[model samples]
Target: MTLKELLGIFERQGIKRIDPMGQKFDHNLHQAVAQIETPDAAAGTVVQVLQAGYTIHDRLLRPAMVGVAAGVMQQVNTSA
Candidate 1:
């Protein structure tokens, strides 16, 4: 699905979309959908959201809403 379609999910879910390039969720969403690796259920949800036609941005400048596996640690040091 195109990025425009992905942002629609956020609008439906009432979640705000942020433009964080290289972000995990963004990256995962793109990778999963692009590679057809995302779970069936999740992919279905994405399709549903897109079909709903609810987009985050008003006109342009919107990103994708990704559903990635949780618990993955960020690169930031947490052992301080």
Candidate 2:
């Protein structure tokens, strides 16, 4: 069977894809490999997914390897 067909079979068996591309970075679901500077999207947004994650039912089978937009984690105005 083709890879697509195999994936379909897995999906039918309750395998779900965790494609969090363009979604907000979640520490619980995603593993941020790098924080890149990108103005194309909001900071902390998932810019790229190195590896797709998977799940079965409500259990997390794997965390997605991703790169998130870079920005100040906590911007503080020192000038008063």
Candidate 3:
């Protein structure tokens, strides 16, 4: 069977996908694989999902692997 067909079977049985794209990054729900610079979203937000996670019965089966928006570092000057 095709991949979509196989997945459809599981989805029918209370298996759901955890696609957290464009959502704020949550450590409890998502696993940050890398941080990327993005102006489109706020810092610590999810930019892209490298791997999709899954859930069953509202419980986390696996954490979604994603790339989070990174904050730009600022330089500070100290004067005597």
Candidate 4:
């Protein structure tokens, strides 16, 4: 059987994949691996998924390893 077939079988068994791309960062569902500063997306949004996560029924089997978008930091002059 192919990988797709295996995945289909798992889905039928109530194992589902968590898609985190473009979604808001949720500690319950995602594990932030890095904070990426980008203007393309809002801060706290999931910018990249390093590893796909799964869930069995309503229980989370693993959190999706992801990179969260961070707002560009503005340099504040401390010396006056």
Report how far residue 45 has shifted in candidate 3, in Å: 0.9
What is the C-alpha lDDT profile of model 4 across 1-80, one tens digit per residue? Answer: 99899899999999999999999999999999999999899999999999999999979999999999999888899997
Candidate 2 C-alpha lDDT tens digits along 23-47: 9999888999999887688998999
The lowest-lDDT stretch of 10 consecutive residues in candidate 4 is 71-80
- Which residue pairs in candidate 1 have backbone atoms (N, alpha carbon, C) closer than 3 angstroms, thus clashing? none
Candidate 1 — worst ten consecutive residues by lDDT sum? 46-55
Sort order, lDDT high to low: 4, 2, 3, 1
Predict model 4's lDDT versus the native. 0.96
Cα error, residue 68 of model 3, in Å, equals 0.2
Off by over 4 Å in 2: 72-80
Candidate 1 Cα outliers beyond 4 Å, as residue runs = 19-80
Cα misplacement distance, residue 12 of candidate 3 (Å): 1.5
| For every candidate, C-alpha RMSD to the true structure in Å | 13.7, 4.0, 2.5, 1.9
- Strongest candidate by lDDT: 4
Ranking by TM-score: 4, 2, 3, 1
TM-score of each: 0.22, 0.82, 0.82, 0.89
